[model samples]
Target: MWCFDNQKLHMNMAILETQSEGGNIRDSLLLTCQSSSNLIFGIQPKQEPLIRSLSESELRQMPKERFNQNEFSSIKLSKDLKIRKEDIILYNRESGILRDSLEKDELLTKSEKERRKTNREKFKRALRVERLHFLLPKKEKNLKPQPALKIDWSKSKIKTNPDIIKVLKSFYTNRRDPQFPTGNQKLLLEKLAPFPIFSVENNLRQIILAYPPETYMKNLSDKLYDYYYRLYEWESDTRATSIGFFFFNPEDALMYESTIWKYGSLSAAELGTRLSFFRFSTAYKLNRTSPPEIRFLFIPDVKEVGDLVTRYRYQYGKQMKFHPNQKITRDGFADQPIYTIENVQLKQGLFSRREVSYFGELKDHKYIFFTVDGAESAWNKFRQANPNLRLPRRPNLLVYNFNSFINDCEMDPDLINQNFIFMLNREAYKALDKSKQDTPKVSDFSIFIDNRVKPQLFLIKIWAKRLKLVLFHAPRINEFPRREALLDGLTNFFPPSLYRVK
Candidate 1:
């Protein structure tokens, strides 16, 4: 067995020695010491480590060296200094270099040199911007912003409930009847649009959809509030604003995504981003409270939509889902079948904010063969149905032969076998050459399942103006008048408190 002497550990070099056996030396070696206990064979066994808090002055002595060592390629160290192989590995990681500095080191052979370095530079910049924020003068008290006044219908008196009901009918996106509307789509929107919207196309489809049976939310207390992404307050003056909060956990992350718009003091990047820009599974709020501000917002990019009428069919057309990992994505029609949903438990990552997301089994999955037209159509429908529901911005009307996304990626829509996301991954895998390994894994190709949205705090926005609206529509509110009344309450932000969202 080997043992380390009681001599002080050096920043540059440390001596590793075997147990004492007479005066003859068995083996002796010099190794670099690092913060991690990788090179050390043993610690001094007889005495406690003299750990104590450093004084404030001593703590202020920050290291002068910026992280700039590249261990990937061979480099000679100068006489004045020595850096740990871990620091060299970190430098290569930060700069997107793949080779490990200490891969040759016999001692560091067991050390984990591989690390995730995606967007390292971007994160460092974000960190710098945040640190600078602390030095700026603290925000003034009560600098709460007011909600942007899109309408002042509050001034005029409503003559009757039917008048308000008429307005509610216009905003309603969910229509239970399967029959497609008979009139021209544009004409219908022009006649029915309550607010002065910029444009319209096919009115958005509205239908009740079942949540996965394995929902974690079902066990939560009935008093739980449905989460939302709301445009609470629009900024006015930038001089002074309300103090905002930072999120440290999953629960508060839900609060951040729910805060949709920019406000005083808060950067636009901090607020909930638009659905198209969002990388996470847009956690759709079954119990909505926001005023229906948008109509069918056209999703730019993908190809034109044709009618889909096969397996996994919904009200308008069939929908498909693709799993990101743990099994290879497939068309599900071949002899080489993917794992069945019953056997495969879908993991809702912690990033999904478990308190607000659906986990359990990936439910109601059905497949279609690879086709260019169908893939394009499904991609459009999936994005429309899923993403925008979480953070809808401007109303993008119907789709034409839009090709910004698919063309940009140069992906052949026909190769897409599973859902739009899965198809993208499959296409990318095909694009890569099998130079590294005989069997390429998902990580080999530069492909990604969508990353989850981080939780954020929307304290500043919620604290400002009389901008609350209860998105009271849910599967549980079955009766007609009660549903209508809930809609009526959500139709205006400044309206009197009328009904609970539940």
Candidate 2:
């Protein structure tokens, strides 16, 4: 299936290959021991098609002889639109009239006029509020073009994990929270605008990788998969308590931990966390902290089956400048909307235990965001447009100690503690064993807190005796612990890359 959208490169391109010869992408897809893909095996062959939509006239006007990523460095309308003075005397009467007259009298070329008109329209809409909070989701953030890292299946491939396959077949059951907008507390509901989720046209599921390079998908993906298995859902725990569902496979808890230790390490998990934080820092647009419309799955277990194939159903509307590397999306995307589907079928293989997780709504997509000015009107339009589409009961995602994840009251800048309990890994158990010395009165072990600059090393306090790791300490280092006249600490490694402001 051709998954690339109407405009620019979409999704992780490498996971696919043109099947024009056989007329089947599945045949080209890796179908070896890996029953399914943790990450779609690889991208299609390099495509040379230019932005066929761009006119010869427009291409000539580009600043560089070639395309420029900064060409569309978003123009922030909110800043100029805000009104500060309580009294300006009709813009000082003369000043207002003179400014209006000068603007009306100025003559401009057709192209210039079109550009100005587009901006003016945005300005006019912003009149309803300060620069109409572009609240629209942003897809691209400026990133220097870098080549996509190529993956060769024959070299250093992840060995098949029979245990995980067995475990999923035996224990992984499908689960859903059926919750919606449950986590939208930071954002007020009255200000929200409900938009229908982006649909899969013609029932084809195309997974578009918007700006995959911007997040360094290759490097991130590299750290995710080991020689034996992939850490597809290492962050599953983070989402489990927030917006996502959690099912305790207690029957296989200890076994699962031991299995992971077979191939990966805690350091790998830390690197994964840093990469995630890096994505969080660089993935979103300036106006939004996170993507506004988060897709919280109704069926948690389905996603656990990260082994599904790729290619998605998508609607590409509007073109924007993107990364300027060698071959993909450099010239920009199509100006018109096109519905294209890149289908990668999920192979159920031998794990046909519907008794464990009978298929849920595997194709449904739900998305949401908030609007300040037209909340009522937006919902009214939504109600009239899609009467059949129902919203989940929860407004936003909810977390057990979600609030404690941050310092709302701004308490101790150094340490803000919360209630967290997790089973200690084998490393902690080993530390406990060491603490018990040869002395008969003492347990042979040592006590230590995993203060490694790890962004995801969740273990904060460890009780060697009970072998329980306590975590989630919101540390506010307004004054780094080693910042006084008496303490000038070692400098930050990546600095701020691992830290979150909120």
Candidate 3:
């Protein structure tokens, strides 16, 4: 084999010679030697051929030298070098280069050499930037910006239990319900099973309708709580739920979408605690006797609401059916189809948190195809009926336009098939995206769905950690009170003693 040994070359050969009876030249000669890397051969014993040393240029003509002359040159340097042409041809292989049918022994041009040099320079610059901007600073703690979130009452279009209404009024007004009045002086909220002031307009009939299903509102409250505890000091501040709430300043609204106002740090537990507060399949409680406070509060981004709703429908609407008798059920002859309880499965299933979210399976796809307007309306109704019983108000309200979503689905994967979060405005999401882009090296949450693990289960765990609300939608029915319902409900209701507020 051709190789550099002490920067020299050598060869081995066997030959048959007869002591001359008289001085006479032989008829032929036998040669043996290595051809190239990983090859060796000798002339056949019976086939004696003429052999002679080759000049440097002549040796360069050999096939082995045509590709890697530097390697084959080592062989030529040896006085002992020897080989048979047949064996050399048998071991020949191209040196990963092509030049028509015949091989050539030529060096690459200077331009090709320069191109490689340029690539190496680019690599060094990239390495330097990466070290300074990412690797070096990763160990340093990140600074958090001040927290800003919006909190307010929104119009509801579904039935609300009298007790929950009383609780909300008490919390909002900081006062108990009024004493009995002689006439119709804002009849006691307790007397109304469902309040009318919060009604919404149905896109189809344009009629003021009651709120969504009971469970829907309950899930909404769960989302609020999920968001509420995202603060770093929430647990220490509020021993009851360990969640903190911050309101957005009026001045901040104008610049809400800016990156300067969006980034902050709160413990992962804070978000998890909030998500654990709802009625996920059932409910889950944190194991600690005194859990950490949650960091909650962030501005809402309304522009993203449609995206959030589309995701909700994809996860829960696939198997639902609308019944005509139900409030959300549609009447004959319209551009949109209505959904109701009759044709849906009202089962309590885990949607996000460990606690189960209340959901129903629809029996028809026609209802879903009508549009997101109808889906939004039906979701409102769905929320009103299920009244998760544990949570206090409607889950976060998400309005969507189906036609717009389907048309734009190809542009954004999150808008079409994944779980989404709603912000009060567009700026919040923009700020988040910018922060992530600026620090491209950060690791993100991911899930692997396989035989032993489900993607939804991982999503639930992550949702809890982020203190984010989730909604699932599908072809037939839309799932409500997502991850918030599961994690928050379980965490809030767990260990019973924590329920006894200090």
Candidate 4:
């Protein structure tokens, strides 16, 4: 049944091809009907014309050039001439339809051609409108507005710590203290602006809470001391002495003493006694003499002290009165006399040097003057007299004054007496000036003081077994200690309330 149907379909295709190629449409239909009848009747069909398939080479060799009018007429005249089998098949399938359509159009009247062209344009317009309609709803859907995004404020909330809040509140409350100006409070807040306030507050609170009050207070005091210890004003000044006084109880002084020792020298701890003196003075309204008499003797040059009387007269002038010549006292076994200079009145009582002694009573006077060379000579003679008695070698200050000062103060007891304050005059300024020249950008003199002077002062303190005298070196002529510098130094250590001049 399938084979019969297939044969009948092929016969119909042949009839269509024949009609499309200019064969008689009626005759082709009759042939197809007869073939179908034969298939249905079970009669064997007659042999149809054999159509030979052309090779690819033969099909490619066919001429593709357009024909002129004469050539076209010739092609029409030879319409019945048989070409290659493939050519016939190709023309019957596709090219034949196109050729027939062209020939039919040529035969049409002008009015009929115009009518066909208009119909074709109308059909194209309808197809384009249908396509536009199909896409219009999709474009409108795309152009429609989307819903606005809804924000969740809760998700963007700022995180805060309770401890930080507590700390901030404490600072704010303290800011209202009568001691601090509102302007200063604002300035402090501005300084703190760059820091994460909450984070710092939280960390500080945690640290403070972690330690006991005593431990925490001590730690804070230590930190404050370490920060300011190198400043010349703080090294031996009364303000530095007063720092831990208000913060610590009298009973805790020993603890503070031990703690301070761990950080710096014994001299540094002794400086705290200045606070005691301040407390006494404030409470009693009278200066306390509990602090030893600190006498500053400025030696301009160490080499110029061969004859004490002669040098004193030359330096201070004849107007200055000196004590009558007296024999220097010595220990019972010593052959040489101990060096002493007494009662030298400068500028008619401007201020007087009551006595100058080498290895003698250093606490007996408020002022003393002695040359470094003279003191060394006296130390050598005294050492020779008592062979068993040991004395440390004298410090050499000629080459580097400041360095020598530090070394001697740390090593030599004679240099660091409780009652004696040694002031290196022009030599100190020269040394410091030279250092500055070598490195001009050092804005902080505290570094130099710490690295050079403080260690010697500390050594002197240990030798004296008491808070040694405060040493003041002249920075310029007639300006041994700058009062302004001292006050400014106080500002670094004390709260504004305490630093107020009484």
TM-scores, one per candidate: 0.16, 0.16, 0.14, 0.13
lDDT per residue (tens digit) for residues 1-502 in model 3: 0011111112332222222334331111123333232211111234233344223343222111012222122122123534321111111122222432221223434664465446434433322111101100011125221111111112111222234554454433312113222122122112222211111111111111111111122345444543333221121321112222111121232222111111111212222111001111111111111123322222222223333334443544534332332222122221112122222233356653333243435322123222333344555666677666343222322223322332233244443223221112223234334435553442223212221144356556666644434323222244344434434544322111010000
Question: What's the TM for model 3?
Answer: 0.14
Off by over 4 Å in 4: 1-302, 307-367, 370-419, 440-502
Query: In candidate 1, how many Å is residue 78 off?
Result: 99
lDDT of 1: 0.23
Query: Any runs in candidate 3 off by more than 4 Å, and if so which?
Result: 1-242, 245-429, 442-502
Error of 2 at 416 (Å): 38
What are the lDDT scores of the predictions, listed in order?
0.23, 0.22, 0.26, 0.28
Which window of 10 residues has the lowest lDDT sum in candidate 2? Answer: 195-204
Where does model 2 exceed 4 Å of error? Answer: 1-245, 252-259, 267-502
Question: Which runs of model 1 end up more than 4 angstroms from their true locations?
Answer: 1-157, 162-267, 270-366, 369-502
User: Which has the higher TM-score value, candidate number 1 or candidate number 4?
Assistant: 1
lDDT of 1 by residue, 283-368 (tens): 11111111222211112111111121222223322123333321212222211111111111223575552221211223332322
Cα-lDDT of candidate 2: 0.22
| Model 2: per-residue Cα lDDT over 1-502, one tens digit each | 1211122223211112232333332111111111121222132333432221222243232211211233212222232443211211111112343444323325545665566566544333222111111111122235321211111112222222244663463334221221222333222222111211111101011111122121222243433331112122221121101121111111122222222222222222222211001111121111122221122211111211121111111111121111222122323222111111111123345764221111112223211111111122333454455445442211121111111221221233322222212222233233334333321342223212222223123333212211211122213433322122111232222211121111
Q: In angstroms, how far off is 198's CA in candidate 1?
A: 24
| Residue-level lDDT tens digits of model 4 in 1-502 | 0011212212121322122233322111111212232332123567563343223343232212233332222122135643221111112222354555333567667876676556544433322211101100011123321111111111221122234554445444421132332333333333323311000001011100111112222345344433332221111221111111211122222233333323322223233321111121131111111121111111123123234334533444443332233222221111111223332222325564332123433445322222434445545665576454343344211211222332233444453232333322233334334434554453357656644576577656554542121244346555534433333344223111001001
